[model samples]
Target: MSGSFYKVECPDCENEQVVFGKASTEVACAVCGTTLARPTGGNADIEGDVLETVEAR
Candidate 1:
């Protein structure tokens, strides 16, 4: 099954960006360069607010 995409809001800047749920590497905010998610060997550990979840089609 395909993984999901998350709409994350940076806690520091409130910048919104799409991040892979199973991201292997660190996912950073585009505007503020804040860590949005980090690899956890499974699903990434989301560091900010998850505004939405988009399932892969």
Candidate 2:
């Protein structure tokens, strides 16, 4: 697999973040402070069914 940093859209705050080499327990929206699903593998393994957006603005 390609080991590189990539941006992931926060399903809560809609903030784009580079998740690829940062250890974290929980991820909150960088813009709206909405708590996101627990990031798998620091933050690298982002972009997937990790979040759910019901209604957005």
**Which candidate comes out best when scored by TM-score?**
1
lDDT of 2: 0.50
State the TM-score for model 1: 0.90
Q: Write one digit per residue (lDDT tens) for candidate 2, span 1-49.
A: 4344445677655676645434356655667776544556643334323
- lDDT digits (tens) for residues 1-57 of candidate 1: 468998989999999899999999999889988999999999899999999986664
Alpha-carbon TM-score of each model against the true structure: 0.90, 0.41
Clash totals in order = 0, 1
* Residue ranges of candidate 2 with Cα displaced over 4 Å: 1-4, 37-57
Count of clashing pairs, candidate 2? 1
lDDT of 1 at 44: 93
